[model samples]
Target: MIKKITCNNGLRIISEDISHVRSVAVGIWVQAGSRYELPQENGLTHFIEHMLFKGTATRSAKQIAEEFDRIGGNINAFTSKENTCYYAKVLDHHAKHAVEILADMFFNSLFDPNEIEKERLVVLEEINMVEDTPDDIVHEYLWREMYENNPLGSPILGTEETLNSFTKEMILSYMERHYTPDNVVISVAGNIQEGFLEYIESLFGQYKSVKKPVKSLETPAIKPIYTENFRETEQAHICIAYPGLSINADNIYSLVVLNNILGGSMSSRLFQEIREDKGLAYSIYSYHSSYEDTGVVVVYGGTSSNQLNELKTSIFDSIENVMNKGFTETEILNSKEQLKGNLLLSLESTNARMSRNGKNELLYGKHRTLDEVSETIDEVTLESVVDLAKEIFSHKPAISIIMPKKVDL
Candidate 1:
């Protein structure tokens, strides 16, 4: 069973006890990310994520790593477009230690000036790495084209210029505004310990601050723009994006089903036709990125410069066929079963369960069980899937391509 506790300070703790596993996965989910950042503060959230592990008031960076190693566990964190997560997976007996370390970093990071300068260089190199990789950078370009001036379109890594401008004072100020109790969720799954609830309360309850509600995102009204950059690479990278449904939309399940049939798996239409039949590309797939108020469907692939047009045409043909002819009953049923199987299989992992709990609560203000999610997927009918396909494909495609400079268009 899953349980949630909201402390007096407004920090929400949600957990599930699974007796079968001896490990527990704990995550601190803060409702702050690139979307919450100002234009001048594009990558501040991701930057702060890096700084938290640098050190705390009582622990050095090396000490933090050694401690987690002593516990025989894992600790890591990531920043997304809408939220940031710092998590640890450890033996059940060490849950309190992990939580304490996390709380220490959360409440008392030193953000030493020396560490800031070193990490700034580190992040600059990170930005260089992304810029050099065509496939990775193309998606960032696609979002920029799709959302235009919106924060949602901005890269989480920010630009080198922005990274250089960030200071310790700026980092502290950003954290102060965004890291309030009401904007955080502590999620845990697997062998939850006795007295863990009170232990969590004691650690987090004393820290108190009120946060303003997240500002509403301005919807982008820009038309789809095609971006092509001439580069000298062995293969041309392609990324195509279209508008998609939001996380809480009624048609979300249908969109999931739609993406699967389109290019989600090796057996998907794009994969089978573009790669298997035509022998065009080795990597090809479709994905849906759903945010709170909006979402996007993206299809990405790579091919030789000579075959780029064929690959692009084939992708569009696949979508056109689905939109006009629609998927057969068997296709819809199989995709539904596939989604259900994926969800059920993931629940067996403590980390997956903990992540699902945190994300659902943060995004929807409620938690959903595996059964409930399966039912939601099952409710998607072929008609609904086809209708959603039409709705999603109705928008013009935003295309981003990076090709060799010498290659003729």
Candidate 2:
């Protein structure tokens, strides 16, 4: 079971300690991401994440890195459409140090002007890398096409204009506004000390702060947009997708089963039929990505330009098979087992448990136990899976295709 504590400033902290473990994973999560962006503020959450590591008021950039590395611990972070997380994993002996460092990174970030300028360039380069790779670029384009420029469809990396226009003042203001305790969750797992609660309480309890209203987001009327990028690559990377469901949607579990049976695993139909059977393409997969209020089911593969039509045919045929025939009881059971096993295996790492609990508390309300999660996965039936398949796969999904300039289909 996980214990919950509320800091003085109302930041909720959840912790789970296991016996005999030599390490602890701790994470700080903010319930904010691209889904919360304004038309002009697309990538600010992700940018702010990077800026925190540059330097804090009490620690230099190099000091931050060296300190974590010196402790023989690992620290990293990520920003998604619905949340941002910063975490560290350290030996149980360093538990205090881990929490202190995690807290310092969040509360004391300097947001130095020089650092902001440098990191902007770094983020710009990251964006450039995203653009240069056709496989990556197509997914972003698919979102824009389906959502028609809505915040739900916006790139996690703020657009070029917003990234270029951001200033230290902007970053600071955004942080102060959204980084309030009410928007934060702290989670720790494995080998924790009971005193850790008091430590966090004493540190954040004094954080006397008031609430800031979070900006509201609206999903756009569904519109489909498609464009072809003529890049210089041997095989065409064709990606197509449409909106799925936001996180916490009742249909989420069904979407998971549908995605897995569709192309999530190597043994999935997409890999078996499109690659193993016909030898059509080397990479083929379908995934249903969920956010807080919206999501997208993406299907992708690479093939010779000459095989474009054949590839399209195979994809449609696969969908048709799922919708009409669906998966058998054996397939459904195996898929659920796959998902359950993946979830259980992931928590073997202290970091994964910390990150998972942090996100759950921040996004939803409580972190369900492993047994609860297992039960939910087991509850997914073949009938429910088929219902989801028919409901989702029956639609005429919007499509996007990318290929080389010189290639003709």
Computed on alpha carbons, the lDDT of every model, listed in order, comes to: 0.90, 0.82
What are the per-residue Cα lDDT tens digits for candidate 1 across 1-409? 8899998988899999998999999999999989889999988999999999999989999999999999999999999999999999999999999999999999999999999999999988988899889989889888887788899999998888889899999997888788888889999998988998789889987787744645557766534888898876788999988889889888899999999999998789999999999999999999999888888899999999998988888989988998899989999999999999988887888999999999988889897778888999999999999989998898888899998854554
Q: Please, what is the TM-score per model?
A: 0.98, 0.95
Q: Evaluated with lDDT, which candidate comes out highest?
A: 1
Model 2 lDDT-worst window of ten: 204-213
Which whole-number lDDT from 0 to 100 does residue 272 have in model 1?
96
Candidate 1 Cα errors over 4 Å, as ranges = 210-214, 406-409
User: How many residue pairs clash per model?
Assistant: 0, 1
Tell me the lDDT of candidate 1. 0.90
Give lDDT for model 2.
Answer: 0.82
Q: TM-score of model 1 relative to the true fold?
A: 0.98
